[model samples]
Target: MAQWFTKWIGWVRVIAFFGLLFGLIIRIGDPQPLETLRNASFDFYHQSKPRELTQLPVAIIDVDDTSIEEIGQWPWPRTRVADMVQLATAQGAVAIAFDIVFSEPDRLSPAQIAQDNPDIPPTLLSKLTALPDNDQVLADAFAKSRVIVGQTTVRTIAGNREEKREMAKVAHALIGPSPLPYLLAFPDIVQNLPALEANAAGRGIFNALPDPDGVYRRLPLVMSVQGQIRLGLTPELLRVATGGDPFAVRTNEAGLEGIVLARQLIPTAHDGTVWPYLTPSSRSRYVSAADLLKGRVPQGRLAGHLVLVGTSAIGLEDFRATPLGVAMAGVEVHAQVLENIMAKTLLVRPNYTIAIELVTTFILCTLVIIFAPSLSARLLISLSVVLLAGYVGTSYYLFVGKRVLLDPSFPVLATATAIILISTVNYLREERQRREIRSAFGQYVSPDLVDQLTQDRGTLSLGGESRELTLLFSDVRGFTAIAEEFRDDPEALTMLMNEFLTILSRAIMDQKGTIDKFMGDAVMAFWNAPLDNPDHARAACRAALKMIEDVHAFNAKRRREAARRRKARAGQKRKSAPARRKIHRIKVGIGINTGQCVVGNMGSDMRFDYTALGDPVNVASRLEGQSRYYGASIILGEATARALAETFAIMELDVVRVVGKAVPETIFALFGDETLARAPLFAALCATNSAMLQAYRDRQWDQAESQLAEVSALLDKLKLNMADYVEMYSGRIADLRIAPPPGDWDGVFASTSK
Candidate 1:
């Protein structure tokens, strides 16, 4: 029935393309924490992947763009942030934070609330209860040191709208009675007063509030405060910088679960707010509220460094959106939660991260019952890169060595819904066996392995898989004397060797190369595997310079069909005899070598052929038959010329020992391009091939026959190729110029045959 309504309109266009990517990830909302840390650094290089520097610095003082061009806007007043907490407790800073919310008071110098009440009237109701009480110079720089401040959180509903806030809590801030009735009181914005919350040692409630998809991931650590649970200042400032518990919180029924400090539990999932802290704006940390009200910088950059101040200016929208971007700075998400608890990453989620997503969808229905229909988009992308690096390396090793919280977004959405139900049963068996080997190897290889072999075609092998190769050998230079001048109707030599083996099999399948047959016109290919490539000598020197630039564009279209058959027989060619043209300036050569041969499926199990074999594949077909006596159109051997060092342009050429081997190596000369070899007689034939291979590895045969007689007088004054390896290096420099032996020779010259 019209293929079941085109497979139900292609599964309703794949469920409306993941419901329009979950409604554009829930129409991007949940921001604020300096715009979710400038959209988590605009999703650092577009939505996470860069974990890089072994990932752990945890550094944020960022009100960014150099703390808003060295601090000023976004609410900068509390006696100019009490001289940036006395210049971050004189710079050796390990902790000085604030996502901001001094809560009122400092209406900017109405004369510092008459010296914070110096006994009498400086009146208009004492300056009308005289403003500028920038929280007693921020509680005398929060009584000198380890500062952290910020408070704001709200959530209420039950009965005649009892939402009333008048915040300034900390007097005897304890709550231990436990029944977990959500509360966190204090905030008609008390803007700090009771002696700046008794000279503040620390405080944290920046309330990270995300989850309408603007993604904060999670960080609410603890929530309720007046009926129970109170924690927050990023687990009480990483439990007061590792000394532990400014007040511990442990509740049960898995709500405010175990946020430890010394005992460690710390890995977070944040929802009740607290998650903003990220860093790196500079190590001069966060000084400016006008350079700490003019005492200029330095006291060891504030003793212990968690230092944050808010409003990274752009008119203080406090930016947001983090996994590490928008512009970054909701106090660097508590400086990425004190550099993720001093570098513990603390992002994990696998407390059996939903039982490892039901055992990765029961091992994807046991690999669709062992490769249904016989899988092979390269074994379903090598089993989706070994089940995505074994489930993101077992959730990044339970968040960097068991800190924990492994839910890698629902086991990466149940491994993309079990690789989309084994790729919709491998897209309904490649749409019911309609195989053109996935449109003939989908323009050769990757389309994510052709949509993982059209989702999973029964773990494929299609009779081609073997290993142990090193083949390559090119031809052309007078192809057997140009096919002995094409004999009579050899059907024009079978249509010019089938249009030159279809232009050398489409330039060896456009460098994704494989061809192992064409010997009549020479072509043999090999790399990592029938399909792997671990940089096979840079994919066989980029498929021999794309088969020598498609044989110089098939000898420039047979020299424009032999100049239009000599201008369509200028003055009538004596019948057919004049057609003896189209030799098209030959030049194919190319040879390469590397070992460990034998790669995949030999012919005859209903004619198979994946190809590759050994003896470095007949010494790369005897260095492509010594490239027609060395005018070389690309040759290599000293182990594919020292396994391609600094990617090509070699020279050293020859030490012979060919025609079925006996160790006499040195040959090189892929030729030209060390930026045009360095001119001056190709830089003295590369300094007489490094002083005649260090005087022929110190056997010194008359300083290797005076560096092979100045490399045969610089290849006869640079017309080049001093043929047949220049009298095979002057007959091995006259048999080592008469019986010379070696001493400490490490110039490994060994290769006696094919």
Candidate 2:
């Protein structure tokens, strides 16, 4: 399992790399969500540090509420508007522009008044009809001053009336490809009356379209009206103020680059729009139209300043949302554009900025995916913080120091998202490994040990270490015959094996032992290697005793079930063809030994198992085989017997040399726990058993027989079936008496079979 994971780990990073590329692709598309995020970032920059105002070259003549109250309601007769133009011109203003369009004839004209007031006397009506027209008067005022009339575009022409279109008086020249296709286009325009437009020095469209978010950030300097290119109000004002030179529009393959006028290059976006760096609205830039008309404004207050005439009255509904989160009058927005253009403080997002942002995002996200797994989590977080800070700082520097608009939102958002995804993947992967570890070892060891290994993976290793371990081997005494009973039904055999193994495995795990493997009907287990256990010998002994007790209970239950089946069959009326086969009871022999052994994961690199290997392990297996010969259920090696002698009911079984070794080992039999060991009955039996073993080894046949008779009576009292052991010793003493032993006789018994 470990080898499989190592072979495929690199795929995770490769997937992350492609994911970052997809993010970059989405950035290039500039979806609405991403655009909104970028716009918000730019808004924050503007709000934090708005454009600084020094000496503004433009002034707004606002038709505010005061002006409406003092000068009567709006559309206050073109003659009154003509008076404002005359007054501002008399103040030595360089040029004046209107943000208002006079699209209709004046109803206050003498002729129109005469027609409306038919009830008046004929003589008075005739005299009033002969007076000069109010519109004509306004036209005359325009002819005397440098006035740039404003026009606005409409989406549709109202009614069926054929509208007359008047072209602007200014000339336009192009330096490259035409910009008409890239500009904002409209079907119709609301232009001034022919007389007013004809007398004006220049005509420009005053249309301030808001962004999708209803915020005014960029204003178009050039637009197409009815298939013809027209200049904006502020650009017209600049041209007329500087001797009305022809507009020199520069273009390239990407679209409109900028507009050149009066030897000054004004940068613009691809759509011929300019991003105005705005300051908060200030009263110092505004002069009340009421004050000017009433002769309250001082002289030279608007002199040398390009003046804009527009209404700021709330009733006019000309206010627009600004990036600074303030509502500014539409007319003031135009004035700000003029100020920005003249002062060269306009914000510009160049065509290459998107490229720079994309490259930065790609590079940063790629680095995150590549290094996030190898680096510690703390280091990764710190690096991400530094990178994000640097990106924000660079963007802010460009915005404030260079007047450049480079969006930091997309790059930072993309990189941060990448980091989160990579970190999440790593965390999930490690969690899965931990779960695998728990699943793999949960059955072999106690839950506490499994949990410890899961929490601290560093403790796990794939190599061996030498340590003192108690090894156990348990096997069904008659497994071959048991298999023959279920040879026709292999599934039943499998189920029987699973049931017994589950019981034995539970016993071993309860003692905090690690199961090595299961071979056929036998189970091998060990302790004190993966985790330390000073009482491993006692634990192994306890497990063996538990196995014996549980197996006895299991066999009793099986015998009852078998008896019930036989009685039910006998009660049936039908005759059986042959008697049913007898069921066999289950029993297991356990052998335990304690010694220093090398224990760890052992196998091929791709597959492995945790097990122990040493001479002591071999001796433990040999003792298990020797159990059937001694008619014992459990046998323990000398080392393990000594460890448990004080806490368990153990008896010395024999000192024998097994088939594989030359040295003899004293093996003991385990019957019960400390309670049984402290019983008086067990103590009496132990004394008689010791005397019988000593008499037999001394070659005293008559005394050995007498002691053996007492030992058999004591074993019967204890309900132990060791008659085969007593008979074997009886036959050995009889043979020794018939044929005298050689002088080199020893008590150590040697077995010829394993």
Clashes of 1: 106
In model 1, the worst 10-residue window by lDDT is 170-179
Compared with the true structure, what per-residue lDDT tens digits does model 1 show for residues 1-754?
A: 9999676456534554454345334324422433344333323422333332323323344444444455544455766667666665565655665676665566555565455557665455466454545668678778776676766654533222344443444322222334244333422232345576667776666676664557665666566543434556666666555653445444344333445566655534422233333333333334445554455554444444555666554446676666554445456555566665666654444234545545664565345334533566667767766776686677556544554534344434434554566567668767766666666677888767887756775423444434544457777777766676676556786787788778767766766767777777777777677677656765677677667777778878988887777775663333554445446466788787877886666667466666775677877787877777766777887777777774556786656667676666556767644454556677778787788877777777778777787887887787665566677767766775686546654645444443
For each candidate in the order shown, give its overall lDDT on alpha carbons: 0.59, 0.88
Question: What C-alpha lDDT does candidate 1 achieve relative to the native structure?
Answer: 0.59
Count clashes in each candidate, considering only residues at least 3 apart in sequence or on different chains.
106, 0
Clashing pairs in 2: none
**lDDT of candidate 2 vs native?**
0.88
The number of the candidate with the highest TM-score is: 2
The superposed Cα distance between candidate 1 and the true structure at residue 639, in angstroms, equals 21
Best by lDDT: 2
User: Per-prediction TM-score, please?
Assistant: 0.34, 0.58
Q: Report the C-alpha lDDT of model 2 over 1-754, residue by residue, as the tens digit.
A: 9787666458778788888888888988999899888989999999999988777778999999888878887879888999999999999999999999988889999999999999989999989999989999999999999999999888885433486565664578898999988988987888999999999999989997887788988999988887788899999999999999888889999999999989888999989999999999888889999999999999899989999999888778999999999999999889999989988999999999999999989888888987898888999999999988998999999999998999999989988888888889889988999888788888789888877655776435577889999999988988889899888889988988898899899999999999998998999999897899999999998888888888888888878887887786665423553456557878788888889999887777687778899999999998988888887888999999888757999888778998788999999888889898898888888887788788878887888899889878888888988887778778888898999688887888898877
